[model samples]
Target: MTPAKTQFSLPDDFNPETLMVAKVTEFGVFHEVRRAAHLAADLVANGAPADLDLAEQILAQVLDRQEHDPADPHHGNFYWMREDEFVEDLNAVEFVLEALIPMMIRHAARLTPALQERLLAAIKLGLMEVARLDVLVAYTNIAALGVLNTCLGGELLQTPEIATRGFGKLLAWIDYTNRSGHPLEYNSPTYTAVTLRSLKLLTDLTADAPTRQAARALTARLGLSAALHIHSGTGRWAGPHGRAYQPTIVCETAPEVERLRAWLTDGTLPRWLASFVDRPMASFSIQETAERSRGIALTTHQTPTFALGVASQSFHPQANVLMLHYARPNAPRPGVLYSRYLLDDKWFGDAYHATDRTKMLNLPDEGRFLGVQEVNRAIGLYAQIGADHFASAKGVLIWTGRDEIDEIWVGEECITELPHRLDVDQAVVVARR
Candidate 1:
């Protein structure tokens, strides 16, 4: 079957001036890079799943679009409405492509050897394009891309000449980033951590003892405590000072590095590593307590708005009670409730809750048997009441103002037994039923 034609069209209501086209382009690059890395790691840890085939097909379409569509500027430079309008900086494209190379290799390995060979051939061409780009490449991007290439060099189909060139470019990028006094946009504690990580991977794969030693020395300079302190204050892993600074996904790095270090040295990654690595490193303790339902004990600690992305919901009796406890600096504050449920096999819910103040219903038995079922029942009842009778139905309820709700449910029927995403605004008194 012929592939669906890729088209570029601005929305009818598209207002180009209000949109940050450059920022969006950068975000796209960053997202693709991170996604590629994540998928690579996943494939390596758990053999290739069938979904990968689907991903490959999608990627192929994207590649074709990038290659053939003149209307679609290769660097996301053109505004959707004005094809002639071009943005000068296309740095993000190179960074994103560089990051994607390693991910593609990992993906290739999971395929048949013949397919793997074909992928490697395609990757070389892509890498060449990435390397030849004229955009002002950042050290972080170069380092990240270099590390991936180093890790997979032995397995990829690229010529030794191409591999060596790619490696050199990566090193140059890292050197520039490390030495440049300019503040990094992605600077933060986690930025340092991921950079170190990429360096370590490169060191390990290339068996470059000198490079490894240098990277270790740099890491040591970025002290664990210093990184943590920075993260606590700024909620990121990036340069200590820079105007281009922004929040990072990998905010907590010291603990993660320590955990990875222990695992590498002792041959066992703690089960806690999974959650610990994902959480804001500084707030790991609070997150853990929230997950374990040990909220009452954690009252002494400060709590912020809790946001959790649920991967699976198949645990136990209290599984439904996904308690999110936040600490208020002053007296008791009302809690906000927002839930994303799977309806008819498709997930739906406002990204933000519309109701802001739902009266907290006192548990029927004064905290005797409050559990998941009771909490869900309360929530379900709230949904049934047409946004009015929610409080009268027993149990705590909160009205997320319409402005707060961002997602819309998209399914024909209510879905159960699927994971739900939840976001709560304040500390909730999860009383026992």
Candidate 2:
């Protein structure tokens, strides 16, 4: 099947004058490199003389940002921002290759000989960085894209060793996911879309039959997981997410949702499962053991009116360890309730120090208690810790909705106010509708 032409254009927020400016202290815009690569590719595909010259300028800007020092471990990688000499994110390569690899496959011949050589060398360096970094498959999005970058890069550059390793990593991810019941970054509304896109790329582009077949099956599995969790009433990706940046899915036409919808409507799902997509969902419960030994069992319960999600163990800051989403009357969006740990008035899962900003370590602070739930009603317990562990310890339960709260109870205590701050340590807390 012939692919439809993508009408590429600059982002709405694009600033031509400040395009080259770099911020010193903060992390650079992540999409800058990606957009530049995409623009360059689009211009080259246009094949006009002026377009080719502009593409060269953009490519030059992108290549100049790459770290070329042979002795440096971060060689061939771009910094978090142009002014960031000290920090570099490994995922930079993954993001770049999302556009770069496909461009190389489709429009390499269109590129001027000189520019083509330069772009090819830059991509090879990027792939080398990916090889050295070796992102764990548990990361879901980056790992899947890393596999694609290396495999596709190998095929493009004729490096069999890299391709072989990429294939091996792909198989390992499949094996690990099958055993764990889901990816380590499970039920993430944000990263799941990225992972699915990577898997779709692998399924479409890989020459290897086994890899292609595996990717297709895995895509379907993830799609099923995503389809199940979407709240039928509110149209929100239901809670108990292993990772989520926002509390709720406010927009039904969100890019991630659209991507998933496209794949689902393409007749990939079975007839029985496809029925669930169009019909109203009544009630369901799903339990997934993300990791058996570490006790990361995730459970989500969904009904038409409300949904409850619980995690046996704490994850990253993006995690919703305990979450409740309920339908709001006369409102299209759902109500959100979730939990997070705070230390010294800061999120505990956040980077503890400035140095750990780019790579946040998942510290072992497993003092959190498990939650028990039956449909919308749930109970959560928190354990107390000494000052030695955390400078200031507190657990924050955030609630967002349009409804007025009539009452809140924590083990027979009637909490009379909204934004209730209380010591939940060694106490059972419950909320009901």
Candidate 3:
């Protein structure tokens, strides 16, 4: 069942048995192929889409997001050289191509010859051009190119010089993912999607022996990470880790529907979509500890209704502050269970619905997340509410058991709690409207 080596032209050091698992139990990429296949079958049985405009619409959307001019993609996942005019993210293009791959799988049998040719040509051209531009974006982007190139046919490898560079780059990417505990240095729900999608393509497209050896291993690790991080119940990614956008909003420009409109129509989407992974994920469960750099320790937990991702203060920094993404609330996009990461940008952190914000002055930086569940980031640094200064608010309610309040300088900004002492080991505080 394995394809020929000539098709992949892999590096000599590759290994074939990398990360081979007993069975496949993941989603996302797995279901993506299913969706594509379903669509292809429907098209073949019913004929091409009546609305010829669908293709054009997807194409246009991709074009709009292209950083044809090197503007910051604002949402970045890692460190990379920047150039003003260079295109930054081709994710739109990546999505369109991935969306088309499933249909391409059944093209010969179901698609009209002309339709197949045009669509294939368009998809191939889009991927190749993006590949060229991706040479600048980042390694992950380049890996995106490598996966696309190999799957569509060894076209990028058609020329010897280009082939050497192209395949070589993929080898390097595989090497990086394998050597580093967290291949995705800056993890995010969206970036995880990108990484998983690329790996999915690699699993299917590349040759058997050499090229996939290292790729298989990394794919397995990344795949496990994806399963653990996502809420099985809601099907949404966990946390706004590193660089991520609201998954439901698509792109931030167009808005009107309250869910779609920027938080205040004051035209600031970040304000509204600033909470935790609020959407519903269908089945949730913890897969494993996500291994990352700095011996950071993070554990993932999932149940049918919700998911919990905890990072040891010593290990995971950004997300270590408690994060809970749910699939049970059955709510709209601006999902609740807000994340502490949002508190990083203090200026914009006050999500209208969020209350109970507090800070601890004496805790070590690592322990800060324990007492304070809020966070705000400046440029790249973290700033919190109760860390140093006093924050004033209204209708704050606070209650706790007999445990002495940590000799932490106590400041109750809002007088919401009854003065009567309650009995217990835990503290309960809820800011009411």
Q: What TM-score would every model get versus the actual structure?
A: 0.39, 0.82, 0.45
Off by over 4 Å in 2: 1-8, 18-31, 42-53, 247-259, 265-273, 347-369, 384-391, 402-433
Q: How far is candidate 1 from the true structure (C-alpha RMSD, Å)?
A: 18.5
lDDT (10s digit) by residue, model 2, range 190-225 = 788788778776766777787778777887787788
Expressed as tens digits, the lDDT of each residue in 268-312 for candidate 3 is 122333222233434433322223444333445556665455443
Worst 10 residues of 3 by lDDT: 354-363
Q: Which stretches of candidate 3 lie over 4 Å from their true place?
A: 1-89, 100-105, 108-128, 135-142, 150-166, 185-187, 205-209, 212-215, 228-322, 325-381, 384-433
How far does residue 356 in candidate 1 sit from its true spot (Å)?
Answer: 28
Q: Sum up the clashes in candidate 2.
A: 0
Better of 1 and 2 by TM-score: 2
For model 3 the local lDDT of residue 263 reads 23
**Candidate 1 regions off by >4 Å?**
1-45, 48-59, 65-100, 103-107, 134-139, 142-155, 166-194, 207-228, 231-433
